[model samples]
Target: MRILLVGEYSRLHNSLKEGLEALQHEVTIIGTGDNFKKYPVDYCIFPKYFLQNRILILLNKILFRIFKLDLQLAEKGIRFWLFLPKLKNYDVVQLINSNAIETYPFFSKYLLKKLFNQNKKSFLLVCGEDTPIIDFMLKDQLKYSILTPYLNDSNLKSEYWFSLKYVQKNYRDLFNFISLNVSQLIVSDLDYKIPLPEKILIPNPVNTNKISFDNLVISEKIIIFIGINKSSYIKKGTHFFEKALAIIAQKYSDKIEIISVENIPYNEYINLYNKAHILLDQLYSYDQGYNALEAMAKGKVVFTGAETEFIDYYNLTEKVCINAIPDVDYLVRELSLLIENPEEIIAMGKRARLFIKKEHDYINIAQKYMDVWNRN
Candidate 1:
């Protein structure tokens, strides 16, 4: 099958491409490398000059402020329009999200219509923030979600603009357009799945072959690592992790080492966390994200979302990873348990690797995607 995956998210599409190619399918990915993480893509529409040049970037910001025009998004749209001919004629085309091209809603709709018309099948992946998920949150459907912090404190409104924008008329219209064009909607994880209950749920793919599991050896201090993306700091509930870490530092200064980093490239981020015994991931997730899954595949005990729903879905789980919440006390307690019982850390790390192999193996996940695409 000839597959065209539009946009990249936390290396999900790249890993899926690898698996599909291994199964003798031709796959092409076009995206902006997901910002600073820099995930690879076959056709990159990244606004390099606009993003890299200081003057241009300043001008772009000023233009947005004055005229509500984003130069970078415009550049991306133009680039994607130029690449439309080559992007067509695929057996299947899957969008990473509603705003896969990261352009204005009207421009995105226009470009997507062209791609959808040319492709044999069109599917939308609900892996991140979109109109439906935002709507679900706004209605207070979930017990708690990524929007919890923002709901509690309206002062964080600025931080949530990206997500809140999905509730606006323009974005809602874009969502309706995509929904009408696409064959079906697919979700990547429980976070997205919970909101869009009717959509097909497919777990994120992880290339276990590339990520080798190393048995954790903790002879002295238990190192804890956390990587933060400034843009998502509030949405991801990173402050809760920070507060928990601070308390852990004071109590277990001699027993543990805390490493915190912000806004680093994907490769560097992974390499830096390799030595740590524990990796602190996002708090608002109900299932593991790409970062946590990759770390789990590497036999590192990760503090991430392993909620009851996730555990029940995977059944007979022996603590594959820690379930992180927004409470600082809970986080500190979980950390203390792991620190006090280092053997469980090694045990959980082993379980985490096995869990990834069983539940998120790239080849298996890719095959699942193929089945869904073919069935619909």
Candidate 2:
């Protein structure tokens, strides 16, 4: 079947496209131009630079005040017709609606409704609880696809209300709309009162193609976690890992080296992972991020989160990646053990790799998508 995927945030479409094509299905990916690199498939480009879309939207808002034109409505009106011809042509089209301000086209409920009405058979793929218009656009859907983890699942959601203040009210309203409209909700198995169309637990997809653990020669070196940014502590557990590192590094300073090249470009990172024997994933959030998964693929043992659900998902009671707070004392003890027993560490790393291959390997996950699409 010919499929068109729209939006390119989180690089998910690329992974999905790669997986589907491997499954012998035709997939076409489209996204904003200029920001993307050479992807596996030539994606659709809706050209809008930072200055162009933001400035245009702001100008329209100013115009709204002068002419009393429902500027938001007016812009939505123009884009609906402008984009419909291109959008309505797909057999299955996935709209990647982001919560960011720039995703105006994806946010237009009326446009999506019109397109869906025009073509009733198109399988609408909506990801995350983002977009203020999801419920309105997909109010009749008997199901939902929720990818992002629960808002309160991590400690970071304490700022959710504050973050909501910046988004336009209508946009924020969409979260509740999705809650009301969805018949089934797809999400991680976390303890949260998220309203669901029906609760479906689908863990995040792990890309095993980029990750590997075939032939690893252990090196006596410590590698700081990659893919961690300023928010790593809050979202991916940067601080927690760092604190544990402080404890672990005290005795192993001469034996194990720690380096955090979080800002390294994508390709270079894998090479670094190849060199390191261990990867510190996250101290705060859920177990093994995509970064942790990548490290495991490179044959690095990760020491990070082990949330109750994640522990159950993998049945990992003996934390290979010791999940502990920044208590230097605790992390130091855990690291000492790993550095002392390299074989055990490698064994755990192998387990990590196996878990990723069995669960997140995008190829298998993509096949699952096809199976879902071609159901009885």
Candidate 3:
């Protein structure tokens, strides 16, 4: 099958592409490299002129301030429009999200309509923030979510505008348009699956072959690593992790080594966390995101979303990763438990690697995707 995957999220599409290609299907991914993470894509629609030029960057800021217009998104739209000719005639086209290109809703809808008209089958992947996910959060369906921080403190509204914008009419229309165009809506993980229960639940794909697992050896100090993306600090409940780390650091200064970084590239981020025994991932997630899944594959015990829903679905008896929440005390306690009993960390790390191999192997996930796409 000739598959075209639109957009990238934490290398999810890239890994899927690898799996699909391994299974003898031709796959192409077009995306903007997901900002600073720089996930590879066959076609990169990043706004080089606006991003690289200092004058244009300043002008973009001014335009956004005065006219509430993001020139970067417009640039991305133009690039995608130019690439539309080569993007057609695919056996199946799957969007990474409703706002896959991260462009204005109206323009995104226009571009998506073209792809749908040209492609044989269209499908939508619910992996990231979109209208339905935002709507579900607004209804307070979950006990706690990424929006918990912003809901508790309205001052963080600015930080959450990227997600909150989906609730607007234009985005809602975009969602409706995509819904009508796509044959099926496939969710990536429990976070999206719980909100849209009827959608096909496909787990995120991780290339276990590329990620090697090493049995964690704790000699003197347990290294705890946390990478923060400042833009998503509030939305990801990173502040909770920060507070918890602070407490943990003060208590176990000699027993543990805390490594914290902000907004690094994906390669560097992975390499830096490779030595760590524990990786502090996002809070308020019901399932592990790509970063956490990759970390788990690397045999790093990650503090990410591993809720009961995830456990029950996986039918696990042992703890693979920590279920992070928006509570500093809870996070600190979880960290303390690991610190006090280093063997648990080693045990969990092994379980995490096995879990990824068992559930998230890229080849198996790609086959599941192929089955779904073919069935639809």
Overall local distance difference test of candidate 2: 0.52
- Positional deviation of residue 292's Cα in model 3 after best superposition, in angstroms: 0.6
- What's model 1's lDDT at 52? 96
Question: Per-residue lDDT tens digits of candidate 3, residues 1-376?
Answer: 9999999978999999999999999999999998888989999999988899999999999999999998999999999999999997899999998889888998998898888999899999999899999999988768999888777788978888889999999999999999988889999999999999988999999999899989999999999999999988877888888989889989999999989999998999988999999999998889999999999999999999999999999999999999998888999999999999999999999999999999999999999999999998
Pairs of residues clashing in candidate 1: none
Q: What TM-score would you give candidate 2 relative to the actual structure?
A: 0.68
lDDT of each: 0.92, 0.52, 0.92
Candidate 2 structure quality by residue, lDDT tens digits, 289-334: 4455556656567765555656776676555455544445666677
Q: Quote the positional error of residue 171 for candidate 1 in Å.
A: 0.8
Worst 10 residues of 2 by lDDT: 141-150
TM-score for all predictions? 0.98, 0.68, 0.98
lDDT of 1 by residue, 1-376 (tens): 9999999968999999999999999999999998898999999999987899999999999998999888999988988998998987899999999999999899999999889888899999998899999998877766678898888899989989999999999999999999999899999999988888888899999999999788999999999999999999987889999999999999998999988999988999989999999999998889999999999999999988889999998895489999998899999999999999999999999999999999999999999999999999
